[model samples]
Target: MSIPVAGRRQLNERHHRAALGLFLVVVIAHWAEHVMQAIQIYALGWPIPEARGVLGLAFPWLVTSEWMHYGYALVMLAGLIMLRAGFTGRSRTWWNIALGLQFWHHVEHLLLLLQALSGTNLAGRPVPTSVVQLLIPRVELHLFYNAVVFAPMVVAMLLHRRPREAERAVMRCDCALRTA
Candidate 1:
């Protein structure tokens, strides 16, 4: 393909800020979840007062725990709107921020799924689906949670890849490079 002009790429600051803000929000949520989870872990293993539990919910989240994180997911989805804004000459940095947050979020989700599947939460609920319970009818709830929490991320990642190409194309347009 012929190289396009360099100046064709335009970044919209509004969109970029939005995407960046969203990414930061995701980062904060992940950090919060980890912090809360760690406190819970310590509480469960040792004797602590504040870590005793909050909201009357059981210690450590397995299934319903994810449903709680869905609020985090919605925040992420809203943040992706920055991409739409970015497309129309919005900020380029937002794309990178969004990408990083999406990746980290998925990684955490994977870890949590493995934890639940391994039977760490085995005492609390039935393994509704399981390799161990072919005869006993165990069910693995992680299957649903993983799909719900992480699917949009896969789609967003795919979408994020496109603008990167567009930006590259704009750079090749021979337009004066804007010093970021």
Candidate 2:
């Protein structure tokens, strides 16, 4: 059996896919970072200061630091949802949205680094906070990870200035479909 074409909507799918993959990396990283922070809080017996935010109040919930991580993951999901909308509509807006979200990830890393140096936490508390002191290490890893995730897109976007590579990609896909 073979797949059938509905229309010429196949154009520019590769770029969307590449953007989506990067978005997913951020999503994973977001959750992973928070989880790591939470685990340290637990294992190190750090004090989790109770707090409040736009939602009203923050109750530490329990032992896992899941709330901090959960918030991070939610942002990732929002970006992914935006990407899905962008892909289906083939809208440049969606690509722009994805690009914006990816840039934010870098900002978050810098904030984390600032937190490490200044000893600030999400709750505006100082680092190691009688809990974990891995802020410096985590920020170091994040710097490298964020760069890896966005570097490809940055390079691709620069290459698209010529438009030939993206054009060739679409042509190959069309040919593959036509022959198959």
Candidate 3:
């Protein structure tokens, strides 16, 4: 059954901590994939084309598929938007910063997907290229993007878990640690 709008409210109110925990697991898994790819390329000296991440090793298409990349971007953006209401005060501010950065990251993935679909590489490149990829390589650019987005999210979560008196007063979820 489809959840009503009130379900989102409940998610922010009662189930926010659990939801946020699940979201963090997904984010960390994605990070692991990226790190594995970097290690394969830099440390193992694998050819760029062969340096697919862990899952990509079994399904090499994952590394080359613009759709998969774009789908991940969309998922990340949606998660950020959906979980935003759980944050307040400094946590909310930091969350908003991550949301904005992830929005741009999503846009870059969208551009890449569009280019791949239309068979028109950006700047006449052989493969799909994001805007930032014009200056930095794709692997490094994605690593940077993920790092920036994750950093602020970590800050938001930390602040959320230790909110001030005013913030705690307005919070609905029991995400903050209890004081004696």
Quantify all predictions' global Cα lDDT against the true fold. Answer: 0.41, 0.42, 0.95
Write one digit per residue (lDDT tens) for candidate 3, span 73-115: 9999989999999999999999999999999999999999999
**TM-score, one value per model:** 0.34, 0.29, 0.97
The regions of model 2 sitting more than 4 angstroms off are: 1-12, 50-78, 85-180
> Residue 109: error of model 3 in Å?
0.3
Error of 2 at 5 (Å): 21
- What lDDT score goes with residue 108 in model 2? 58
Indicate the TM-score of model 3. Answer: 0.97
Over the stretch 1-180, how does candidate 2's per-residue lDDT look in tens digits? Answer: 322342222322444445545755764554454445544455555443422111223334432243443355345545544433222222333345545655555355445545555655765554422222244444334434444544543444333332343444433222112221
Clashing pairs in 2: 46-131, 119-127
**What is the lDDT for 71 in model 2?**
55
> How many residue-pair clashes does candidate 1 contain?
18
Q: Give the number of the best model, judged by lDDT.
A: 3
Ranking by lDDT: 3, 2, 1
